[model samples]
Structures are given as structure tokens and as C-alpha cells.
Target chain A: MSEVREPQSDERLQMPSDPYSVPLDKIDVAQPHLFANGDHWKYFERLRSEAPVHYCEDGFEGPYWSVTKYDDICHVDSSHNLFSSEPAIVLADPEEDFELEMFIAMDQPKHDVQRKTASPVVAPQNLKVLESTIRERVCTILDSLPVGESFNWVDRVSIELTTQMLATLFDFPFEDRRKLTRWSDVATTDPEQDQSIVASEEERRAELIECLEYFGKLWHERAGNGGGSDLISMLANGESTKDMVNKPLEYLGNLVLLIVGGNDTTRNSITGGVLALNQNPAEYDKLRANPALIPNMVSEIIRWQTPLAYMRRTANEDTIVGGQTIKAGDKVAMWYISGNRDEDVIERANEFLIDRPKARQHLSFGFGIHRCMGNRLAEMQLRILWEEIVNRFDFVEVVNEPTRIFSSFVHGYAEMQVVLHPKKA
Target chain B: MAKITFIEHNGTKHEVDVDNGTSVMNAAIDNLVPGIDADCGGQCSCATCHVYIDSDWVAKAGSPDDQEESMLDLNPERQPNSRLSCQIPVTDELDGLVVTLPEFQF
Candidate 1:
């Protein structure tokens, strides 16, 4: 097996200004800087048009085929049998010594068993119970934001709201709610690419172990309590996951999954929606005119953001995708970000239309058994956030270009300065 | 065209005339039915189009195929009569088909 190589951030800076200038075979969209610079779209645009199933042998994370077209991504994602999500779902392999075994990366029977146990917490029925709490939190967060002055929207609103939501889901100590945000960032942060959260792999693992130890205490406390609605309680009381306490790594893996799953994705979408709407003021006008479009706009925002860029799946057997042969054991990346913008699949794919018809038909939540479990929850948060924003603010003006995350896997904003213009009475 | 009756979780019924060969999921979507999301657009990929075939129409609706079964099995609320509406095609064999939308589409 070829070892994954980390492309230095500076190497990506040397990429040509024009994506087409790079030879077809040399185009590697997985470079984290491409995402950080927000220059990945043209590269994916070329791939979707020229080589939809193009392979990058010297990619930062070893060799992987990029599935960029809409239908092709759907085919690869839905065919879980042929394209397994085992070992790891990111382009790079998990460290052998400390592999976190989350259900999202597991195959069949085991995946189904573990996923069912935790899914109920975010299921629509439970979401109804959570709706009011979420709205109350949203209102509080929005109310606290500084008005008419530039502030980091990502920090004040996006991260704060999502962290509070995750804390409520876990019933974690309210005072330490920000710890969920830190752990979520630690879990997904690539030490090689960015050391903002942790200086090295060891530091990352150490922080996650702290996370494990903390959740372990919660698990023990709740395991014998019989029944409760929070995620920790659900896992503790769940038949399949009850014994997870014994498997420390597995227990931590799931906690990381739920945390990162609930946190970063929604956090980015909340920030992204504001940036998107500001970029397209007409859509903001449309939104102000009709707040009824909040639900549909949420889906459109998810599609436009494509928060998580791609999900890696290892081919279980030799299979053909987009007329190209993928050998068994080869890595394949279903670039949801690219597929969401494939013009053939999404009409005016490049444009950010607030009320696009069939807006929910995007690949952001993925497909098949491994599809996003927290999708409805993410949508609900965005919907409620927008509803409250429109009611209170006439405009959430983006004051500057947003600082994007420096990872291809997590396509999101790191910081976006915005000023809230209060709605006129 | 076949007549399809979609009953929401709250017991609201929407009767629509869906053309033959249109999926039950599409019929609900086309008619703007509230409960069925059909997120994957009738691919049987996402189970968002999940519905319960009214007890009377259970046998006629038939058992879900292997792919549909795999998707349906993921739903915690899966019942014996549960089926992904995307997998069910509207046909003349059953004109007055009634399906109840689940409280949530997970």
C-alpha cells in the first residue's frame, strides 16, 4: 500500500491561476489550499466536464479516483456493497495505532446496528421535541450578537449556536459547552495541514482521549439510569451500544462522530448561508419579501455550500464508474461538492438561488445506508436560524471575504465578519 | 391515471390522480403532499420517501425488493407494512391505493 503524502501548504500556492492551464491529468482538487483559496470550483468544473472519473495518482492522500458528476457520485455513494466505507472515509488512512471506529465508516450489519441506536436522538419525532429549545437558543444567540458593528459571524452565531445544540443533545455540562466545539475541531482537524487546534498527531489524539475519558464518565453515569433522551443516554441504554463502554476507542469514535457530525457541518452551513445570501443580494431581497422561503432556502444553502467536500470509499472489488475501471482496494472520493454543482444535475448549478425548485435534491446528505444521519436536524437548525434572523435583522451584511477552512474534506468558513442591520419597524 | 390517497401522520388525507408508471413518491411530490420528502427523487437511495401501505393494501402493495428492504430496515419505525414509496409504481391493478406517511422521514 502506498503511504499518504501531505502536500505542503506552500506547494498548493503555486497552482496556476487558470485551472484549465494545468494539464488534465495534473489537476488534483484534493489540495487543501484549493479549498482554502476558494479556487476549487473551476478545477472541479473542469473535471466534471472532461474527466468525471479522473484519477490522481500523486494526490496528497495517495491515489484516488474523483467522482465529480452528479449521477456518477450517486451511483458510487448508493452502491455501498461495491464501494465500501471501511478502514476510513477520508482520502488518508486512519493511524493504525489509534483507529476510531465510528458507524459512518463501518459496513453493513454493524453499521446498521450502531447507527440505529444513536439516530433516534435526531429523528424527526425527537426533533419536534427539540424545535422549541433550538429556537429559544437561536433567539438568545442572535439577541446577543453585536448590532451595526462588524463581528465574526462564524464565532458569534455559527459555532455558538451549534455548540449549544450539541451540548443539549448530549446533556453535557452547559458551562463547558464550548468544549464540544474544541473536541469537534480536534477530531476532524488534519494536523499535517493545520495546527491551529493541535500541534501534531499526538496532540490531536491526546485531546480526543480527553474527550473519550470525559464521555466515558457520562456513559457510566447514564448506563444504569435505564432510559433518557440525550445521545449519551441513548447509547448507554441502547442494546447494541450498551457494551460500548468496554470498547473505549469505539465509544470515543461514536462521540466524535456525533459531535463533529452535529457541530461543523451545521456551523459552516449557518455561516455559509449568510455569505451566500450577501453575495446574491437579490436572493436576500426575495428572502426579506417572503420569509416563507426559509425551509427551501436551507436546502439551497446546503447545496451551495456543500459543507463537507467529499467522502472516501474504498472499492471492495474491481468496478467501473464513469467508463473508468477502479481496481479493488483503490480509493475513490465521491466529491459531493463537485456533484452538487454539476450543471447537468442542478440547473444553474453555479448560481446561488434562494428558492430553487427541488432544492433538496442535492448530494450534501449523501445517499444509501451511510447517508447523513443528522440531515433533518441540520436543516431544522438552518431553517430556524434564518426565520429568526429575518424577523430581527433587515440584513446580515458580510463585511469582508470569509476565511475558508484549509481542508478539502471540510469545505466551510473559518471566519466571516458581518454586521447585522436591524429590521425597520 | 390511478387515484392515490396519501394520509399524513395527523390523519389529513390528500387524494390525487397520478398517471400510470409515476412513482408513489413522485405522485406525492407532484401533488405537493406535506409528509413525503422523497429526498433522493425516487431512487430508493434515501429512505425519506418511506410510507406505510394501509393495512388493507398491504398484500397488493407487495414486499419490498432487496434494495428497498435494505433502505427500509434502517428506519427505526419500520413496520411489517412499511415500504419506500419511491419503489412503488402507480398502476391500474390498484387504483384506490392508500398509504400513510410516517411521522418523520429518517
Candidate 2:
């Protein structure tokens, strides 16, 4: 099957400047340019009102249904039997030549078996052991931040902390921890947009292949050593996934899934929280008044940021959602980012209030069986980071507009310049 | 204190004494009960801690509010006695509470 390609010409990302005044027929929320230019909020809001279960006949990634309403998204995401996660979980189809076989893209018994293998990593017992280690590393990263000087928070704080945590989770080589972040970006990035991420599709595959080779060595070593509690060891030792070594593509796919799953959600939320607090100073003040609210504030931040914009599913059979008929084989994209802001489900849906009731009732970690297994781990990381931040920095001042990732899938920052001002004792 | 009996989908029973004011979700998760994932850390989101209240305890378990009801609607297996364990607070008035874990909490 031929996949939809992003427009790469001179007018590649050109979008209507006025989102509010654009004709309803012209709206395509899947356009990466809308997100890249930070112009999607109004467009999605318009879709929520005019067409909640909208269909895009001209989506860049081919025609796919956009489930923008919260209830509709829940219906689509929860009814996995009717809407399959197979083939792929994004608008883009798997490459015909090199299909990645991660469990999140699989359905039923297979998804459950492979998912159970990695579930122990985020088990409550393991988190108890990892908390102090995470807090210590967080404090070290925060203390090293240069006060009274503007720097890229993405690099200085967000990436550094999350990368370190990923390293710990995988027991990866501490010195080359940044590679995890790199592979994550490459996995989701479009080569057409930036050469720095990946110059071409071949290079993307080569880099990922190289990623598999490295992890492959780790898998062998861990398996020989009788396995352990780390994610790689768990996969290698788990009955369902042990033979993944023979299936290199599946191994690579699961590796990519774990890397991206463990990396993006928390890292982006870390940066987004800083930008959010700066954008909504009252919320920051509320946070400052009672550091006890850090835990709840963390959930609100994740809900508000919605790091992963959406997860796609293919309709297995004809179904009605939001009073719209969706036929079998139709590509369905559950817009978690839009659902996070659904006004009816979440009161004051657009605001950044930390004290909002039912703050965690959002679609950021998704819903149903495909719900993020690392959700509590992600929340704990953010909660601890903010706890440390409130005690130390009075403000994480955003100096300029953030450069957001061009992809519609990873709703995150590429560069956000900020300065941390220390609190007066 | 309230004594809560959690029966896994396979019929494994874990009876624990939870302090009044603790949530049934936390009680299960804290005790390492097998069925309740509580992936959201007891948040009303991610309906992973869904349970079926015994008919005897249904009235005492109380009906779900608007938010909890909205979440429960997403669970296909949800029944009239269904309640999100996270939303149910343990209290002395309901000393012997029984919540049967669903086969699928996803």
C-alpha cells in the first residue's frame, strides 16, 4: 500500500494565517505546519464545535477520521475490537519494506503478552526502589542549572533529566544516554523537515538498524547472565518475547517502542510544565504557595501538554461514532490532544489551572488497553522534578516563543529558552 | 478501620484492613492485589482500577458522580454495580466491603 507523503515543496507548510476565519472545508488538523507554527489550538477548537467526529478527505497522511471530541475519542480508543491498532498507531502506514512490529501496534492476546513482559518495569514495587535515585539525579540536574542566564531548558534540564532516567530504566551506558533521545526523535521525525534529525528515509532506517544492533548485544549479554529486572532483560527473559532475538525487526520495533514510550511523554511534559507555569503565572503562584500541590499539578501539566498528540487506529468494521458512519478499513486518528481540551468533559478545558477538580481525567496517557503502562512512572518523575523546582527556583522564565516539533504526533518542544531564578531563602 | 476483601477475576481473595479514608484502589495497590493496575496512581482517569461491588454493598458504595460515571461509560464491561475503586473511599460504616476485580481492567 502506498503511504501518504508530507508536502515537501516551497509551499510545503503554508497554512491559512487566520485559523478563526478559515472556511470549514479548508480545515485539516493533521497538517504538521499548523502545529509547527503553533496555530492548531484555534483550528482544533473550531473542529470541536463544527465537526467533532470530522473526516478529512485530504489529510497529508491520506484520508483518516479525526475523533476530536472526548467521548468520541474514548469510544474509538476503548472499543479496540471495532477499531484495531494493527498495521500502525499513527496516521502514517508502516513502511512496506521495513515494518516495525511493536506490541502497541498489535491487538488482543499478542499485545497483552508482550505488554505484560515490560509491565514489571513500571510496577509499584520497582517505582519504590527508583524514586530516591530519580530524586537525587533530579536535584543534581537542577543544581547545575545556571542562574540569571538564559539557556535552552530542553537541553539543560528536560532532556538531561529524562535521558538520565531512561538510562537508568534500560541500564544503558551512562555516557551515551543521549543516544536514547536521538533514536526517539529519529523514530518520529520526518526527514523532509530537518536534515539534523534524519536526512533521508534510508538514513532513518540505517540509524534504527544501528540502534537494534547495539541493543541486540545488550539483550544477548543480559540473557546469558540469567536476565534481571531492567526492561531489556525482562523482554529477553519473558516467555513471549525471548525469541525476539530471532525476529530482528520485531526486536527493533519493541526497542523503538520502549525508547520512545519511556522518553517522549515525560521529557516533553517537563519542558511543557515550565512553559505552562510561565504562561499561567497564577498557577505558578498557586504552586509556590503550597508545594503539596506538586503531585496534582504534575497531572494537570501532563493533561494540558498532552505530549503525544494522538494515536491512530484502523476501523475493523463499520461503526457509528458521534453519529457518523465509519466503514471498515477506514483510518481513525483519536486526537488525544484535542480530547484533552474537550470543554464538555473537562470544565475550563483550555485553562492551566493546577487546582482544577478531576485534573487527571484527561487523554494524555490515552485510554483502554493501549493506555500508557509507564503513566505512573511519568507522573512520579514530573511530580518529583516540580517538587525540587519549587524549593529552588522562584521562576522558570520563558525568554522567547518555543520552537515546537514539526510532527503532529509528538506535541513537544525543540527549543525553549528560559532562565531559572533562585528563590530567596 | 474497614476490612476490604478484594477477589481477583480468577477468585484469589486478598483481605486487607484499610484505614478509614483510604481509597479501595490504594488499598488494593498498596497491598499488591493482582488485578488492580491503578496505572494513574489512583486518579479517576485511566479506569484501570474498575471493580464490581457486591450487591449488598452497592448502596453503601454509593453511586458514581458525573465524572466517575463518565469514565465508567468507557468500560464496555461496566455494570450497574460497577465502580472505579479509586473513587470509593473506605469507611467504618462499610466495614466488610467486597469488590470483585474484573477480568480485564484495560
Candidate 3:
């Protein structure tokens, strides 16, 4: 046993893979490279079918329980007592001691407060007002792309969407939106992999101070004048969103939550959706044919893309799931990437069928109370963008294979070059 | 046209006349009832369109399928009365029925 394990450890240490290296074969809930294999959908199809709640010792994310089945994931999400989102969701925070961090690392009573403060801003009703602007932003960004010319779709469009939308909501200056997006990408999505992030921690910290100062200004303005408006005002002023969470820790946590929430998740979804459509022209054509199906199509795209692939839940007291005993404080990762394609849950799960009758039933936004607050807004953005794409662009095609971001937490592309030409009416 | 009554959680009743094919969720959305949110636009994923059917009408409305039953587990205050409004397509049998909406669907 010693000899066998010794060689494996030696081999791993001897040859390090990519910076954000993830072995696609393992049942890691965090692997972003599952798309590398054509079997991305069914990489764990057999495991999900077999164990449902199997533990993976081979996971780069480490020995966390992989909850792959539909019901189990929902069970873990809802029962916050048993499966806590705090301590850490992705893995142990790479930056062990960073002063600029917040209470996103804390559990209940705390997570509840932060989530509450941030939820309303991204809520469905508020998002409805931003739909037209989101559409206009998508078009304005897309229109800038040259006809039949290749450009990085992820960099140009997806990243920009997240940057601009988040900035608009936060009322950040327009010019600084992209900077905020880049800083957010480095800060939340594993600062370890991006060396540029490591070298520029000081710069990132400085910008963060600037942002905090700006927000501080907003808080004072609201506190004194009381505009009776803006998310910043409500957050700086609103009373407890949850019963036990009226503290200032959550207020700071709310900042981290809002930044990550507003940025990466939607960024990946947009890039993934566009790539999926370009790859499957038939699915794109189906969407083009009805146009009315844009809503359902949006659902399908989210499922297929599975952005923010997996969320980590720390085990509370010792418990059993899928017949496996989980020790207290054990990290259990609910692999939404796998569950989205669970054959038991979705028929022909691997195939990207826009017209799939039950495609809206994906767990990408998650289940239970932790279900994404930004879901409606995400769909609204997707629907309008698709509608506009079909109506405006005569032809859009992937001109080069997309270069994926080297992050285990966010399953997304960093760059995907494409060509677009206006349709001749 | 079919007549429907919505008995809200606050003990308020809303009545709407609808065509034969619209769903209970659709009716609430169409009539702009204060509580009902068809967030998935009448899909079963969001239990936002949840309603509590009258005990006497559970049989008429039948139980939700396995998928919907699973979805409802994620919703709050799950009782025997809970059902996804999208699964219950509007029909003649559902006419003059009363359903109640949960307080927080977000």
C-alpha cells in the first residue's frame, strides 16, 4: 500500500499539469475541463446512476462527497443545517489571510443576512426594469464586432455584459466597469491560478479600497439625505433581511456576494450559450423559427451550460446520504454540472435540444431556498439577447475554438473568437 | 369561459373568468394576482407558482408527478396541500376552485 501510494504522489509532484489543472476523469464536482472530453455530459453519468451519493477520493477538490443525483443535491441545498454553504464552497480559500475578504466565509445567521441584503436588487421585479437596457447593451456590444472578422467572444461580449450590468446596478462609473469585472474575476475565481492576480494583489487591493470608499460615500449620502432609492441605499439602510442577521459583518459580506453574484456566473452562461448555439445550428435555427420559444430556449441554454458549475456545502453533524456516512465538517460538493445531465432526471440529457419539453427543469440555478435570486434576470438577458441576435445578425459562426478560463470554480471560457455578419433582408 | 376563485393566504378571494386551456398559474399571472409568480413562466422548476388546493379538491387535482413532488420539497411550509400550479392545467373539473398562494415565492 505504501509503495503504491508513494509512486502516485511522486508522479503528481514531478509533473504539474495546467495552472488550473483538473483531471477530467475523476468525479470532481469542481473540474472545469469536463468540456474537453466529448463525454462532458456523461462523464459521471454512470456514477450518478450507480452511487448517487458516492465519495470521490480522487477529486482534486479533495475527498468531498459528490452529490450527483437530483433529489440529493436539492436536499443538501434546502437543509442548510446539514449542508452549510459557509466555511468554504469551492475549496479552502487560496488566500489564507487576506484583509480585503468578507463574511462569505461564514455560515448561517451570517450567510442568511448577506443573501437577504443582496437578493432584492437582483430580484425579478427589479430586473424587469433593466431588461430593455440589458438588451441594448448586448446589441451595442455585439454591434462593435466586425463583420466576418474574428474576435474573442468571451472577452468582448460575455465579460463585458457582466461588467456593465454589475456596474449599472452598483451605479459604478461606466469606464471602470471592465476593471471591476477583471478584478472580480481574479478575486473570487481562484486568485492562485492567475499569476497576474498574485503580482497585482496590491493593485487589486487599492481598487477595492477605492470601490469601498465610493460605496462609503454612497452610504453617507443615503444616511444623511435619504434618497429613498438605489440598492446601495437599501443595503446601507434596510433593516434585517433575516431574523438573526442584522450585523455589520453581513453588510461587508453583502459586498462580496453582490460582486461575485453580478459578475462571473452570468458571464459564463452568456459565453456558453453562444458557443452552444454556434455549435448546434439546428438548435439555433429552432430558436430562430419560433422566436416565441426564446424563454424556453433560455432555460435550455442554462441547463446545457451549467455556469458556476458546482457549489460546496460543508457537512454539519455526522450524517448519511446515498448510504454513505459523512463525518462532521466533511466537505460535500453538489455537482450541478453532473446533476444537470443526470439521465434519470433529463431525457437525452447530453443532447442540446432547444425544444426539449421539460428543459426548464434543470438545477443550474439550484433548488430550495438557495435557488439563485438572479434567475429571472438571467433569463430576461438571455431571451432579449437571443431575440436580438436572430433579428439582427444574418450569420454568426465560431471561427476558432474557445480558450477556456483556467479556473476550477467557474466553468467558462476566457476567449472564444467568432465572426458575425448582418443578414441581408 | 371558466370561473376560478383564488383564496389568498391572507384570507382574500380573487375571481377570474378564463378560457378553457389556461392554467391556474397562467390565470394568476394574466389577472396579475398579487401573490402568484410564474417565474419560470409556468414551468415546474420554480415552485414560485405553488398553491394549496382545498382538501376536498386534492383528489380532483390529484397529486403532483414525481418530478413536481421533488420540486415541492424545496419549497417552504410543505404540507399535503402543496402543488405546483403549472402541473395543474386548467380544465372544466378545476372550475370554481379555490387555491391559496404561499407568502414568499422568491
Each prediction's TM-score versus the true structure: 0.97, 0.84, 0.76
Per-residue C-alpha lDDT of model 3 across residues A271-360, encoded as one tens digit per residue: 888888888989878876778887778888899888876787888899988788988988887878888887776788888888888566
Please give, for residues A188-284, the per-residue lDDT of candidate 2 as tens digits: 8877665247788878888898899999999989985677889999888888888999999899999889889888878899999999999998888
Report the poorest 10 consecutive residues by lDDT, candidate 2 chain A. Answer: A1-10
Please give, as one word, the docking class of candidate 1. high
Q: State the DockQ of every prediction.
A: 0.83, 0.12, 0.14
Ranking by DockQ: 1, 3, 2
RMSD of 3: 7.4
Top candidate by lDDT: 1
What is model 3's native contact fraction?
Answer: 0.06
- The digit string of per-residue lDDT tens for model 1 on A15-85 reads 56579888888778888788888889889988988899999866777778999999999999999889999
Residues B1-104, model 2: lDDT tens digits: 99999998889999999999999999997888888767555656577789999999999999997657756764556799999999988999879999899875
Model 1 residue pairs with clashes: none
Higher-DockQ candidate of 1 and 3: 1
lDDT of 1 by residue, B17-55 (tens): 999999899899889999888888888899999999989
Pairs that collide in candidate 2 are: none
